[model samples]
Target: MSDRQRLLTVAFYLAKFNDEAVRNLGYVNFREAFNELGAKLDYSPNSVKNRRDDFDPLFGHRAGWHQIELSKSNLEIVEAFDHLSEEALRAIVFDLLDESSSKQGVLLADIVQGRQAPSYTTRGVTGKKAEAFFINWFQDHFPQDNLIDTRDFGCGYDFGVIGSNEVYEVKGLSGIDGGVLFTDKEWKVAAELQDEYHLVLVKDCFGEEPTVEIYSNPHEKFSPKKQVSTTININWGISVSEFNELDKE
Candidate 1:
């Protein structure tokens, strides 16, 4: 709520915009994210250069993000960071095997020159809550009492049932707009592995009536309805039943 904080918040938003743009443009490996941030922030091009040796003293080896310096006429500012707390930021870079898999992890160089790390919380609704949520979700739809058969620990499918004669590939639709997506592997695997590959999309998790649809024969050739709610349209350009049999017993 302070002047510095307000300015920093806008800077981070622009940083996220720049990073996401870089990823989407298929220049996923480039430094476009940082460059875009500098451009949007109106930082001098020459001042945007980063030096690793500068952070070694203060942040220690934990400082993994490239540090870019911003030079103005009299104001020589060398700081950058995102809206995330530092505890959240470090776990992404050092903890995760390949940082890209981390949803919490991001290109950290955008963090301003002198923001301190936030204190760590020993207890949070992060790990166990996540596992518990998944368990409840699976049980709700494919309850043990109702299921024909269920197996754990590297079961061949995400979920399999004998009575349904289907292989279910369930995915979280919480992030995307009330719609879902299937990877090329999931699409092909679903088609060839079983007679019917049910892409059971779970949306509006706690909302009044959760929407559930069965996508049968989800082949890559079969483009399902992607009723993405963009600026205008409300539903998909394609439908589930176009290629797959829907809600079959």
Candidate 2:
């Protein structure tokens, strides 16, 4: 990449990380990653300006102008954050996921990342460097039953339910080495809405047999790497009726 593009890429990921960090109140890793990338892209410390303005009428001030200005013409490429190769994208995304946990409290963090999977990871998690793997995988394989009411927004890998009596949160665990990851904030939400959280473990290259488990409650017994709350709000009882069977074993 040209120096200009490199500069822009650093700025771009920096902004992305910062945005999420703010959501997390202030993530040190996000700040650190932002700083690291900023330096790598040859952005001097002064280059980062942490505010956007609404000076223009048509469009409000955009964030990360210093970096975004690189792709002034290819708006879509910049907008999509799709400039990176598949591996690069995954690495960047994983970093985002990693930093997110610290933002939320400990319980929330655990709920998000502590999702369980089979001890064995399937071919579904690893393979050729498919850049659009999650997108394509979902579009190709997710349940298309209209009666089931599944839909794709051409958005990111995370998918959700609609109405009140709704069911799950199916995020693509594709391309991961079979471990699970989630932001602490997301985990808090999942634990709060545990009845709906589902880890769409698409393995065997997202083969037909994707592992499906509905987590209506966070496991109290299992230890979380980091939780969203300072105090543990663990559920000692196996509440999910489905899990009651497993509890007995």
Candidate 3:
């Protein structure tokens, strides 16, 4: 199944229990949920756990504070809706499953980064907000420039600019010195695209106004080593000392 489909399946599975599960809230056992979801979805228990890892943050619910498993190496926890009402959660899940491209886009962005930092949950909704902020700023300054959202393509880049023959891997950082995480696919894309690939850093995104730093030909500027088999980490402040600052409104 496609990544989109897998996420939708998970959403669908969760919605099934909304009526009865609402009562459990903070007390629902994750194992029970996983068993039913995995059985219906034909997924392994581990897969259900993995999907919940992504869902916990999206749903704005966490159970680690209460349900703790000493035997499970990863510390199995059960999380349920806390931020939104059960009805609201069901509505959102339905919206996502109804082929809502925009909603899917937002959720996909959150999932792309894997389990998000807890601080991100505290900040606001989906990563698309930050990405859109930067895109808007870029469009305002370079009105003639054409751009394409490459996020759905999973091409390791967020956007592609026409005429410039360049693609951008956009990152939303908390500050100028914040960390930027890239997937292995992005690194490979950057290596292959080389000078044609750029890294657009959108910093101070959670603030009233955000600043953008565009690193043209990032593959030539930053040397990012693999953090894991699938992730790459780059410290922007240390790698690119000089980058053109885009004027923001």
RMSD for each model, in Å, please?
Answer: 20.7, 19.1, 19.0
lDDT of 1 by residue, 78-173 (tens): 122333443333333232224235332232222222343222110111112222344456678667533333325344346565556666665433
* lDDT of every predicted structure (CA atoms): 0.37, 0.37, 0.54
| Global lDDT of model 1 | 0.37
**Who is ahead in TM-score, 1 or 2?**
1
Sort every candidate by lDDT, greatest first.
3, 2, 1
Worst 10 residues of 3 by lDDT: 69-78
Error of 1 at 47 (Å): 26
**In candidate 3, what are the lDDT values of residues 1-249, reduced to their tens digit?**
244344434543353354355344322566776765555556676676665544333233542211211111111111222234445554544444354446543653443334323221221222454578878887999899988988889898998988777898777654444556566888888888988888877776656777888887776888865543222122225323233333331
Q: Cα deviation of 118 in candidate 2 (Å)?
A: 18
For model 2, residues 76-193, the per-residue Cα lDDT tens digits are 2233343344345334333434535333234333332323323332211231212134445445665562123333432222444343333333443332344444446556655565
| Candidate 3 residue pairs in backbone clash | none
Off by over 4 Å in 2: 1-157, 173-177, 206-215, 218-222, 227-249
Model 2 root-mean-square deviation: 19.1
Decide which is better by lDDT, 2 or 3. Answer: 3
CA shift of 42, model 1, Å? 16
TM-score of model number 2: 0.28
